[model samples]
Target: MATTETAPRRPLDAGPPPLVADPAALRAVLDGPHAAVRDEVRDRLADQSAILDESADLTRAELRERVRDLVVEFGAQGHAALGFPPEVGGGGDIGASVAAFETLGYGDLSVLVKSGVQFGLFGGAVLQLGTRRHHDAYLADIVAGRLLGCFAMTETGHGSNVQELRTVARYDAGTDEIVVTTPDDSARKDYIGGAARDGELAVVFAQLEVAGERHGVHAVLVPIRADGEVLPGVRVEDCGAKIGLEGVDNGRLWFDDVRVPRGNLLDRFAEIGDDGAYRSSIDNPDRRFFTMLGTLVQGRVSVGGAGLSASKVALEIAVRYGLRRRQFEAGTPGEETLLLDYGMHQRRLLPLLARTYALSCAQQEVTRQLHEVFSQDTPDADERARRSLESRAAGTKAVLTWHASETIQECREACGGAGYLSANRFAALKADTDVFTTFEGDNHVLLQLVAKGLLTDYSSEFEDLDQFGMVRFVTGLAVETVIERTAAHQLFERIRDVLPGGRDGWDQEAGLLDPDYQLAMLRFREEHQLAGAARRLKAGVDAGTPSGQVFREVQDHVITAARSHVERLVLESFVARVRALPASPTRDVLTALSDLYALSTIEADRGWFLEHGRLSAPRSKAITREVSALLRRVRPVAGELVAAFGIPPEALGAHDLVGPPPADISG
Candidate 1:
């Protein structure tokens, strides 16, 4: 018979800690290095009447127009120019740009997506992928929003597999022009933001052909609209009324041999010369393709940060509601207990809060890493470093977006009937963030890409290979099965010494709370999952299994390894932030929250731990109790924790649900 065992609960009278964290201190920590940018965005959102007003009453056309105007307004204010270099009339601060975009997630997501399309995707392509000629002519206009554009990369048949896109850009030597063609129906660019309306041009991804030979995929600047009219040889169809994000105009596009000057090619990595000869600094086509794509890493990083911000907004709403919305009279006479005081409610919301904090720390780290990589005089020269950045960006985007989807839905449920009401903002939040999981790159595919990078150790040739080829490569490849300890080795070692038998030692509450122990558990799981995946691939290949079959069978394991790797990275990032803080009530509170996040992550995957012998049944049970205890410790300060997110009340758009501000229960 199947059975469930509940951990013994601590008494309700246990209460909260003596010192509660100051909301301002926590806000400083969460705001991270680009606090000024976040604050600026908050200030802007507070005054945006169209966005702050009741959007439900607006028609789709009204919503789209409002969002469009907002994007143009933001661009005029230099918000869109933050990521580009100053030579093109930009602020030349990559981190600040991403921070601003991320902060925008607190307001209407339609505005966020529309801005991303114009600035991050379209302008970014021109800045990063195009050389001096293209930039000198178009970039200033792009940043100013005078020349709106779309990143026309995904085809009807190829979404993530850009290398396989069927659209072609054939160099016409006689006319000194490039003919861009959608070879078939499948080659049509689909779900392109700004394509249905408003875009005057597109940075089109097409297979570049010169002298009857292909040079892989390359981006070309093709004009799609002129004088408010669709250009010759161009066709567009509106993808009207989507599941959400109606404020952004998404549509499909087709090119029937559209011709543009040969000089319109991006040409940063690969290009066609005046004599119709294909030229590139990178000889390998695969490397060239990915290198070109890698320059857009900011898109992934910004999307991840934006997704995490959405999670923050959702958590804040749920947490604030949980603090004031009282239920059955379980405590004093005639007075109902606060919803957050209940064990189940705390279990539901606090762990999510801890995770939101953890991911926020991780987002800060990734953003910093991105700034370092792109700020270099020449960012793409270091191939391995570039690939590493790409891998981390992919993993972070996948995990953060998936987390956003889960957290928003859970928050909606936690608020119960109030959340179900459209005016509370959960409906829009839930609908809008649903696409984040599949944006930039689909979570499943992105995770698999992460796993591939791990198995191959970020090998330069790995991106050159397809799925079957990847399986073949991993079969004979030597793999790293051990966890590489971070710079804090001594701290980790001390924690290990506490458990006499090194991980096998029965159990202790202090040990479980140790950051080192939490990291060790997460690291073990990641390493074990990765090693197991490698062994499975080797066995399948050695037994003469077909390469495709072998890969198909092990795909799930590969994704699991990738997810484990990302989860560990998130935890390590959180622990590092907590370690850096000076001793204070804020630090103490964050430490407990970090511990809760770690334990909760482990508890969720305890079955896997027990199967792998890293944890016993009773030890797993102890983790449950510790998580509950941590929840109670965090519950009283829950309001302050959410307050630190610094989301403007106007942006929250749920004033009715969150009625009057309650007194701080932390005291």
Candidate 2:
């Protein structure tokens, strides 16, 4: 059961009090969490506002024209193929590329997603999967928008299970050409952003067949159109307009017998020799495929960053509106309450605002990971580091995009009728970004991948501990048990000091605020979920059940594990960023925000804690109280927290927040 704090009654003549924040400190947050290449993308946004506004209201044809215009504009400005090699006409900064890519969301999502599809996806595939020859042939043109291309990986029928794609690239040794064809209608490339118009090329993915043996999926650069006309063996049809993103000419493509030189294969990992012998540099096909996929993973990070920026826009609009809009007065004569003064209103938006901050920090960490893993040639790069990059990208993309979607809706409702006005921006923001949950990678499917990664690693440990390895295994378990007991005792002692009566009862508020306590709580839930899932799956395997059957049995459990794991990542990232801040009132407020994020997250999922006896009933009851108080603490600074996103004045649709000089409400 939960209880809400009541709002204080105000006098009749009161306008909403001006609550302010440290813009300088907020600017630091806008710079992101870690010490790395601080991207100037947001700074450049002030100049792009007019272009964004121009594109926002265009018809489909005009929208297509705008996209084309932007392509050339971006290319000329050296912003198009930013993440590619320097020799290939790019900025040669992948992290900055993502940061700049995300900044596009401030204008229009159609533009952002379309940009991602062209540069990050299509050109990225050519860069990551293709060899030096392909780069020499197409890289410069692609970056210049002289050669437009599609990333033809997702078929209509095999978006999630891409390993089973029906398209084939059959090698004809006599012709020294590879013939690419879609097996059937189901294999048509669908939802391809640039395919409807302007695409001259595609990096089509299909199974490779050589000497009558089928190899796993690989990509080859195929010409789909020439001089603005569909090519001889290719057919393209528009996806026929949708709910939003009208600017992108999304289309479907069906290939009949497209032929390209064998050299066109993007064969960085696996290759076909001149003698027609198929071979891969990496012996493990799974490892090779995953590695290729990892190179293109910048798309996921880009999408998450875009979602984060959109969340900021939404929160700024809603919070600013909340500050200015006044409603019914039940207390003082003639006085109407500012929307944020209501406890219910704070409960609704503050937590979501908190989530946006958490996501902002998490996305920054992911950006650092992306740079660390992708920048240099790390032949001996730790496998864990790469997996961490990919997994974090996947998990953060799923979490933040969903957060954006949900937060946008809540913001819309919070603003009532104004949110529905097309000019207000929320309507467009909601409609356009609705697909981010499914784009790049479907959030649900991507989350499952995160869980699978955990399970795969966990299962490997179990598999290695076969009967012959029992002695080592038993010793490991004994060591783990002892460690758990020792750790638990230490935690209990810490909790005792915080307790008012020294172990007589809990200092529930102090316990909740303690970073150590929060981490331990989050750790326990995630480990509990992972361990439980692992045990269930293992039991099924031991019972001689089919592996697929075992997987299906624990699928939901693993999803829960995945969510818990990602939530822990956000909270941990939040705490780390809070700790890194120089001590000041700004640090203190951010610390409170960090606590709100953690405690509110627990409050939402309190059932699990209660069910597992991880939290006592009395402590659980305090979770709500503390969370309510946090909402109050965060209330005064909500607008400034969002302003930290550095959204340009033209990009933000609301005005009340900016009209007043931001005050130092951190006091």
Candidate 3:
């Protein structure tokens, strides 16, 4: 975890040109193709700015109602229809919808969570999992906020293992109905958003049975509440106050033989016919289950985008405050220095600023892929493409959310005690985003999924998610651990192919700042880790070691390989984004930031690089020096970098945290 020192070993390089960049140009790049959506959301948030300030003062019940009201307002305004199909009264722009969701992160996170629950998760489930009949019956009302709902998939006994969920939906041929029931307390749906108070219906995932044949898990619509009353045969309980997101009505639910018409089943992927036989086009239960879940990958993509936006909010607040707040004097006699003037403070916040930019590029790419996959006519043919998208989404979500948690906490510490105060916003930012790492999918499990996909090269249908299947599959493969190139691959290849004498030239200090060099180092680590993990699995399997024990032994390696792969993708995305910008101070500034992000990440993991023989002892230390030097170059533009996030002043109230302005030190 050691990072660059505040003081560098040598004099600072002049680095990029002066800080003459336009914040608008930088904002446009960060906003990607959906710049209009971001701007619209910002304007909407500005009009309701008071909620961001007043949320902390409201009681739990009051806050819940306030968030609910705002969601309804958004729905009534047609904002919630952005992600749905055009035929269903929607704007039919999937990427724009995600962009809007990301912008929502600037406001109260409780409201963000509630909005995500309704539009992103619950509504997404109905749209993606349900067939034409189901969509016609529910889509318009759901989009208009007339029909509230919950995506009740996770049970107490089974969350990550969705295939093993115990809740059951049995089709009764005699009654022509589907009976849903929670077989045990553990089978009860827990942590269901909107279940405690507002949800009128639940899209419940349960094992489907017809004529003694079980057809894996499928979604069935069951009424949970009516006329503000808990419906018959359904039980609900409040999850009470938590560390954060108090505005979201998280709850638990139990169903006691709840019956609905057979047509209530979301039969897009599977169905029961008039003959009372379970049927699905996908023969394998595992393939069908994954396909069903893959359709809902938008939830993961939205969470990652929201997490990135939160990081932007935190960085903007901390950087601006650092620019204004001053402490002990260092340069002038009796003149207090700005907090950002010190090398230590710059090292702390500037690199994080750089990383936020990198993640913005990656998030935009993921959102673009999400839109492409969902907009197609034959979405089922999108199986391979969807799997790839899902893998990247999973990896990106893990990294982005983890970065949000880390960046917010660091920003809080950088601002000193003022950040701890309720009015400053860090407390809320930290508390609300802490659960992001686990909610959509646990970070560890998600990363392992990314690694698993990489290992199989997406050849298998992902029939077995267990450790045994992973080791067995890996051992069976003729492993190809090649590094996939980024969109800027040719340029990277030119730089790499021209390097003098490979390792000898790679060890030079100048190469430390090169984009190609940074990418090579990251790719090298990822490829090495992946190959090593494959070898270890093969070894264990060859020796007839139990699959569980073999997997446990290599679990750390598996996760590391996944993390390394994601870091490489993030850097590549940043580089490609920079290449897209025209030659100007804006491009120069972004290039410098891309360098900082790459080097800082390399520096943080220097030990791993060193242990793997990828970096010589002296070369490893040079990366630290390069990071410190980049920090000095970036220090002048720290304020400008954060401002480009274009967060409305009303949304980031931390301007009030610095008290009165102190003496300027930049001059």
Q: What residue runs in model 3 are displaced by over 4 Å at the alpha carbon?
A: 1-16, 463-465, 478-497, 500-504, 658-667
Per-residue lDDT for 1-667 in model 1, tens only?
3222211222335644554778889999998888888898899998884475656888888888888888998999888888888998999899999999999999999999989999999999988899998889999998888888899999889998989999999998999999999989899999999999889999999999998999999999999999979999999999888889989899999999999999899998887887789989999998788788889989999899889989998888888888778899976899998888889989888998999999989888888888888888888757677778888899999989988988999999999988998888888888898888888999899898888788777776677877787888887665443223222334444667765456444365546766768888887788777877888888999999999999889999989989999999999999888878766678878888898999999999999989988777878888998898888878878888988999888787777667656766442
Per-model TM values vs. the true structure: 0.95, 0.89, 0.94
What digit string (tens of lDDT, one per residue) describes model 3 on residues 304-379? 9889999998988888788887799777899898888788999889999999999999998988889999889856
lDDT of each: 0.86, 0.76, 0.86
> Which has the better TM-score: candidate 2, or candidate 3?
3
lDDT of 2: 0.76
Clashing residue pairs in candidate 2 are none
Evaluate model 2: give its TM-score: 0.89
* Poorest 10 consecutive residues by lDDT, candidate 2: 1-10
Report how far off residue 474 is in candidate 3 (Å).
0.7
For candidate 3, the clash count comes to: 0
